[model samples]
Target: MRSLLLLILVAAIIGGIFFAIPYFRAHPLGQSTNPGATPTINTTATALPATGIGTIKAPDGESIGISDGTVAFATGGPGGSAKMQAADKLKAGDTVSAQSLWHSALTSDSGDAESLIYLEDQHVLNAHVTSNTPYVTIVVATMMTGDNASVGNDNLQGAYVAQKEFNNSSQLAGGTLVRLLVANSGNDKLYADTVAQQIVLLAKADPTFVGVMGWPFSSRAEVAINTLAKAHIPMVSQTASDDALTGASPYFFRVAPANKRQAVLGAKYAEQSLHAKTAVAFVDPSDPYSQSLERYFAQQFTADGNKILATEQYTVGQKGHAALPQLLQNAESKKPDIIYFSGYAADIGVLLSNLPTSGQFATLPILGGDALYELNYPSSARAGFKHLHFTAFAYPDEWDVQNLQSQKPKF
Candidate 1:
């Protein structure tokens, strides 16, 4: 109970587009304890299959499940959420949200870990392991350095906890044992590529390797997916929110919704919850995740009858508030009600700390997406920067966790 409580405050906390464009939509986590205060995005939720596995079957023999998702036991029991809505196809602007991948790998077309999940209905874990007990390996790829490392570490802890819990439950269910592989990408783009290459090499070296759990950044996940695709190894990410990745690779899967969906949520939060009419957006064109979000926020906010005064673009490497003078200029000229950011928290934290220096709109509400869930925001930013508000996913309660586990993919 104590550890679970820590997970909630530390790592537990924590999408989609509008209209006839045909976008993917899933049930949003109503995080607030207050029923009325909870944010809602009306999406659909379907029941688990009778097979009692997380893997969803497609027209083909292929199976799939969302991963790199989230879980929180804060409200008693575990609740899990992936970052995406499963769809056969989704189209918005120039983007196409790809259908969930369900390709047969080795013996299983579904890359999901259904056989490995703990089922609520049965009250036990169900799985099919090779005769050689603990034969397959589920590797976790994450950032282990830089400001993002803390988030990655927390996620890694979850993996360890999951490994232990799954193993114990599997034993009771009369299933095979499984092992885990923890890989740190060093948080460098180039180094991440090297790590991805090494991961594939390791997979080749070990016949027992089966699937991967993640590489948190979309950029890194893409790099790893390129290689994993050839080897037919599957990976599920918890936080990589790149929208273009929807159809990018069959070997890659995300438990979280894409960035576009989160962008819509951000816009909704700003408009309906905050009652903001005009806003300035800070975007990074070089980052696919950030770029996709800029478009999503603009589209949804405008459609809702609100205005985005001006969008200030920034590069991925721009440290501190060095690049914000132009943004501040836009904020001043527009006198917007809020400033929207669609990038990582480290950079945004710098901007928030520098807001007073912007000389205008310093106290304006700062709205963002899940990136604002950065654990260090409060300590890293100025005292008044609590104005930081973002649209983040909430973990399911324990009841939801059982339902989610019962439905994840199986071998």
Candidate 2:
């Protein structure tokens, strides 16, 4: 019985993909802070046969598919002669310089390479494969929308790093091909279902499809998890923090500790550190992650004898402060010591920015859940803000994780 040793690091950041979104600093500037790291958890599992044979195409031509033989990003084509030379060098065994050249080509303002996206860096995953070697397969299913798929693009870049790391690790991987596939599960239920279904089919046909990596948020993960559950293939996530995913499925595993754990931590802090007796929750009904975290935090806090002041719900598009007056009024009545928010960083930022405007309400410490972890700080903070607290699973500095994909035979 080969048990798969799966490991995940607890942090707001995942691997090379780091985002600085919104969240108030609940802890002091230095409270044994961790920039975050994902541990390389171990699982003793039998190696299943895997190879690249079947196609996992997306619907409506809205996917990022790049075979080894193919070059460049899906959104852009491969570059010029110099780029090809750099590509050749990278293939020939020089990564640092070749990657540097590739970076230069991407950075160039001159007509340079038209098939290159300035923000994307997944070419390493698309490196050519000329061998007939058996390989291990991993898929990264992330988003490709929302402002040029900003978050998704970063995750894609991170996957490329994984591919590179796997390819280069000497002791870790003796000599085996690590094939990587990418799918765009654009923040939706049905759409994610379609992409996930394809992954299942791919796993069925291609025995090498060992596991999957993304489906970033809880909503997307909900569909993907169900689809992959049928195949019994595992998925390791860095940032999706829905309490439902906590040991819910054998096929679903997370590197970061779930939101329930985070909520409990917050509750402990409220009871001892802040000495809070009352609390309220701000939830986004549209987001699975937000709702789950909010519920878990409130439950823990209430269990600790904290009064449930009020729980207010809202949608994603609704700005943070749109209902501030009423929320303030409720807070005033309950007079909670800490205000809790559970949602995306963007929405949370709005509330954090506007909290100071509500007189006495501003003085009360505002506490938030893990949705507070992400990059978008410049936009999240208001001009005149005092203090806000947010929780996170991990920090990037805590882990030295890498991604690498190869096409070599196993030793």
Candidate 3:
């Protein structure tokens, strides 16, 4: 009897520590905790190569100041090169004067090649002798919806910034530079196919476009790969962490990790780390991402000798809290140790808000996939669900991490 009492006391203490800590009170989605507040400035401007004489016009017809030893040409969209052409077929060590090569790009339909910077203006550069030109174009394509899809935009922006810096540097290829072409699918549901078709068309117009950057959603990637495969174009994605995409096509690749890996990691934490044995699940029956996670969690939990006490599903945008009362009553009778929610943030927030006052979930752990990582879940509502836990992939923004670690909160 005395030993039983001590075990009970210890359990209470452990539970108390889990809830009472201030860190526990802080929501992961809350304002960034970055330490450094100010951004450092890079004030150095790109220095153009010194040229004896002649003017430099960018692909867009914008004249950049000329310098000795520097070569210039057009950049950006297809429209930028209209009417204007390279003055000559200059090569790597060629010393051809600017006037010699001016308007030299359009000698034939096949000869409308990408421009390059020359060393001597003497011979056509060997590097530009691509069975096609030595240039590659990348396109970022994504669906207009889902957190998973939006993640690609972040990576795309970062890549563009890096590309700009690279092009301006002295380390550019053969004294030439790189260029980028950016397009938005405009949140079009058909954008997956439309944007992909556009990319292929762009490549047809200029075979030098050797690579692509993205398709934010898995479905979009699936659709785009059909064309990308035949074209031999390799792609990298920031989102679409779907396993079905990898190795599915020789040309398909993604830099961002997939959701399957995330779900497995989250499930391990929910089952082993949180010690949840009996769980009740609320899934969104219509969404593939939610359904996939639910199925995996169910299989994993059952494998661990734990049973799902109950499962209740609603459509993607169905009224969630309205069904919660009856579900909670049923779940209480089964005494689940956890409630695993598999839905997007907007819907899950409603379900979480409506959990009944009486039952195991009133105080038990509430676990979820990436759905709970949203910033919109009310802090107070989350406070009510003290035992909530979820998985998040990347560390928050760099500056945010620094501020939070320093405890100098950014408003």
Candidate 4:
């Protein structure tokens, strides 16, 4: 009787642990600060003054409104000002100072409400306004483009729309915005390097450019990040996913999650959830992004006791590679449970068209890296790729909207 009771107790404890694990993983108890979203503002603006600082604390629900030293700040609920209460009494050359949080002057009507008062590196506004239409510059290389039928149009179009919305909205730190200068990289790796170098030089010659927005492919981004680093220009990358690019330089930051991070997660999923017995890796011999991730995935999957049936290489952009037949035959021989491809969507599409319709791979699960997410996947071909899953490290539109909803006014 005691033995049976002990067994029951052990079973109950194991069941409790299994149920609790999911909840703990799903919801973290606390949130950390997003340094990028949070702005630090110190109102103390002086060229060279004794003590070099002055601190001012406004009343609760009131912001330290500083413009040309004439105080005409709106006092209301945290970040509820309908329009800026302009202090026209102050003019250029006059100095204004305050200490408070820097709220999103762009999308948020909560003017400087949630911004923390970090006193370091405070500055006086340039006070020089531009009457000319503001132009936003986008930088990229042709390696970022899509192929026929699914020609990467969706991604490029989405980026263009997002940029237009950002510039036209009331959130602009400067004045009215206008044209978008898209600098193209001619699909050549060498050209990508040159394009990046020219962008920085051009920005220095023109002062109107506020910030840049692209470098779609990770290879192009690898080259561009270094040039933009020296320029000290703020840029937001739309699609670059190389893990090394994160915090690569002071000026480098990505709108998309690092690619390797997503790959690691996929690796874990394959091991723990899918219980994959064997994995076959197919990588583009020419493409750096595909090759790097393929190598990394193979190392990880092998470490997990999952047998790597084979590591095959295919040259990118070359039509009708002889490797497909070998790949199918290998799949039949090894019967790998999982097949991972780190190559362009077009290449994968072609390979899928030629893959053997019988046996092992007919039912084998297919996995891929970020290159698969290119918008060019043919709609008709979507069903053919029923077994395909691609990894992308990015916050979908829903996550951004949730962030907006949860935002609190710092005032």
Candidate 5:
């Protein structure tokens, strides 16, 4: 009887070991069984390069890399993939299909501001291309990601509206059609010069390619402008406002007021409207736009008998972010009457969001140049600063009114 019981126990133990081995193999340790759970990835492994993954053949039989095309430097996420797909469709002469893919990509990326206008322009332009109709291409190059994305979107929309009207007008008299090509210059316009080189290639390959427009950021615009100017391409800036860009190139022209004027206006507003006597200015040293605004603002403020307490410097990336607390602490220590940030909206948004509600900084009015006009902080974040003000290129309603009037020209 003892031997029988021992045999049964041994058999049961062996069976349990077999069952557990298969279970462990199927569901390894430290792995989640939940379907929605994300699997752990080895981030330290050799990762793929963000740009320059694939190549597309241009009209001139030249292979264009991913870094210098429709979605320049935006070659990582779903938006980038979709844009690449659209490029493939465009190359196949299927602009109608490409338009759909572009729309999808834009929607997925929450980039819907220029959607309708972009689609309309693409349809019209692609029709001309497919029919072998004579058309002139104007490339709109700007920062299409990060804080400047809104500005870039506005630029694209404005260009499309102009293109549509020009193409439909009797003034053209059935002349060469105008097509706008969007070239994204990365998050902070880091790839603007590379994109400019690509535009030069396009101009060389296609005789119909005429000009370039929309360099909204100064630092990047300076480099890009030099490249395009050397290539003898006529270029126009929609909203770049740095004084240094005044004679950046013979080919470059801008309709917007320079930073000197904008800073003077900003200084006057701070003194007269905000009742600020002394100020501290925050600037991004790497960005010429920020530097220009800071220099001009300081000069104007001091000229108006107001003192500048200090000027704080910060760049854009990880180092800047890591030092933000210390920078804010230093700025707070200055105890100035007003705080002026002459940086782009992204950094300012971070500064504003992190600013403490109850402190020496509390109830202090913050002023900035037009670069902060696109500050898109959430309502909760915005509520923290009741006196936040920035100079704008123009009022929002005026843009709508002008657009309407342009569409319905009298006489």
Candidate 6:
């Protein structure tokens, strides 16, 4: 009887301990000891893939499609897709519809720079391509999106005007029509080499492709020029002015003066015109054009018995922007008489826009290279600087008949 009672007591104690374990776990040492409250356990076991997210598609779900005499690679947003549609329409010989789409695309929220190719130019190219009349093609390779799009549009306008004039006149033997093919190289011409390769393929397949024009940036222009030169194609750039591009290729030619000449001209203007003795040079070292201009300008300025108080280098994107405040402080500490910016308008515009109007930089003259010609600063931002000057390859008012006659002999 005693042994059985002891066993029964042990079994009861074990059961009581088991019951108390769950109660302690649920209530812990806190005051909340509700009988119905039980601890909840989440059993979800879904795991994220090791490869992470897949490739992101464009917002508008459009892909770049290249065709003979038509190239559509502008893929940013709605504006890009709309322009692609416009290209399709133009290829189908629907000028009216294509022009309408193109106009709408320019005004869309995608911030596409206005294109200069008009209905007449599109019709001319289309007509020449389909008709049997002998025609020579000139591909205009340029960045049709991002900050440099305006310059690209200007290049297209110039090429179109030339094509129109040539096709209208009896210049070509046997009445050969002039056809223009536009090749968009994307923002800052990041895809310039790839587009150049496509242009080479086009030239190989079609003998009518005679030349190319408008390589706006020197950073990627060297590679593109070399590729085209290897294929025996001639290229002419209206804006690329890096000194390194002087002998990049035998087929490469430029309408703009090299960086060395432009830098010397800028330095002379600063010393003679502005009477500046000390300057602060702000350059984007990542860009070949900016670096070349900065190097040459510094050399010429020092050679002319002037001093560069500080040479601050900054890139062109977010990292560069983040460093601007520090760069400005450093430049201010140097007590420069003038500021020389050897960067594109995208960066210089931001720098000037945010510059305080009452500081030492207010009245300090800011002289920049030809890249500053594209500056589109707001009126409020323009008020921040008293004197802002930039060099230009040409001035419209100076290109009169007399000026042309005087300059013709030199050319």
RMSD of 3: 20.8
Q: What TM-score goes with each of the models?
A: 0.62, 0.64, 0.52, 0.58, 0.72, 0.73
Worst 10 residues of 6 by lDDT: 48-57
- State the lDDT of candidate 2 residue by residue for 9-109, as single tens digits: 31112221211101112221111122242111111122211322222333434433222312333333334444555655655666565666666665543
List clash counts for every candidate, in order.
29, 45, 36, 9, 0, 0
Ranking by lDDT: 6, 5, 2, 1, 3, 4
Residue 257 displacement in candidate 2 (angstroms):
1.9
Q: Once superposed on the true structure, which residue ranges of model 6 sit more than 4 Å away at CA?
A: 1-84, 90-118, 125-131, 188-190, 317-319, 378-380, 399-411
Q: Compared with the true structure, what per-residue lDDT tens digits does model 5 show for residues 1-411?
A: 111222222222222322233333343322223434422212212222233233333333332222222333343455767767776776676767778887787778753423444465575656676876565555666655554565666565555545555566622334555555667665535356556656655655555555666576777788777666656666666567889888767667766789999899999999999989998888887778888899999999999999998888888644476776678778888888888988866667667767778866778788987676663555545764575788876553443576765643221
The alpha-carbon lDDT assigned to residue 221 of candidate 6 equals 85
Off by over 4 Å in 4: 1-152, 174-178, 233-235, 319-322, 378-380, 394-411
Quote model 1's TM-score: 0.62
The lDDT of model 4 is 0.47
Give the winner by TM-score.
6
Q: lDDT (CA) for every model shown? A: 0.53, 0.54, 0.48, 0.47, 0.62, 0.62
Error of 2 at 16 (Å): 18
Tens digit of per-residue lDDT, candidate 1, span 37-77: 31111111333223211223222222222221111111111
